[model samples]
Target: MKCHRCGREIPEGDNYMHLGETLCEDCYLDIRMAVKACDPWAVHSATRFREGSGHKGTEGLTDLQKEIYELVKGKGKVRKEEVIENLNLSEQEMQRQLATLRHCELIKGRKEGDKVYLILYR
Candidate 1:
């Protein structure tokens, strides 16, 4: 690949820039830093740096577990049976997902009045 700005051949694994047009790795970083430093407060006020992990860690969850996660997230708190009905999953599958999420520390809660309310972990 060629850097559109410098017309230099871009090496493998080299940073590719997308500043109106593609640029070399070094030039791209320089431009990015310049823009960021131009207004330090604008960049620093976010309180934290967020980056995409690309569902890498999420791959550990099974299909049922992912469904349960989404269900709990949407509903706030749900009983074990509600999940089964909403997801059309077997009791065994629901229990499996619940166990996986609990083991992974992704959720926390207990039972009350024969109903199990699952609280999602942030």
Candidate 2:
């Protein structure tokens, strides 16, 4: 077969490659190593947020808020900043969501050493 990119004759049993593109083992290794050397945080930042949801259009969280609720479970209390950092939410957004959670009796918040901690009531 011939390499699509370089048009070089690809040897037999070299690599199956991706259909039309006859990517050799060396090329494949280079691509894989390049990917491995890139920052994991950059890769994570690209795909952490799932797309295609009604919640994407709305300010109110759908499952992400519930995810935070579940995370705080078992732990008696957690700091507001910790929740904000872990959940990737802003302080104002977390405060609003916490208020809703409190209204629903799922969590309660109080001042602890000048920092607010939310206690999972459920």
Candidate 3:
């Protein structure tokens, strides 16, 4: 079987059914715990954690997080689809990573006309 969300192949009996859609474990979790970038509490908690942890300015980011940061940094600003295509990331993966980056105040989203773009945080 294949996940309806991410389109990854799943072994028999390993897929989960949600609202009549077959989803993989990752997709299920992602849907259940979707990130909220505008939550002030989360931003405060992440900021406090980073400050106390002595990790500054992407110092303790995972490899993928750093890669995403660098990609945005290099581009100045890029459309959401551009990052998705450049990194070959699923939409869910991109959202998770972008949320982390946003919580760290390392990146932000902007609107120009009808589209949103991601850029390094000022």
The 0-to-1 C-alpha lDDT of every candidate, in the order given, reads 0.63, 0.60, 0.79
Judging by lDDT, tell me the better candidate of 2 and 3: 3
Error of 1 at 117 (Å): 0.7
Question: What ranges in model 2 sit over 4 Å off?
Answer: 1-61
In model 2, what is the error at residue 121, expressed in angstroms?
2.3
- Considering summed lDDT, which 10 consecutive residues are worst modelled in model 1? 42-51
| Cα lDDT of model 3 by residue, 18-105, tens digit | 7899999887776554444335566566567878987546655668888888888898998879988988999878988887788668
Higher-scoring candidate on TM-score, 1 or 2: 1
For every candidate, C-alpha RMSD to the true structure in Å? 17.4, 17.7, 5.4
Please give the range of 10 consecutive residues that has the lowest summed lDDT in model 2: 52-61
lDDT tens per residue, model 2, 14-64: 865654566766555544543443334433433344243323211223476
Cα lDDT for residue 44, candidate 2: 41
Model 3 steric clash total: 0
**lDDT for model 2:** 0.60
- What is the Cα root-mean-square deviation between model 1 and the actual structure? 17.4
Candidate 2 similarity to native, TM-score: 0.45
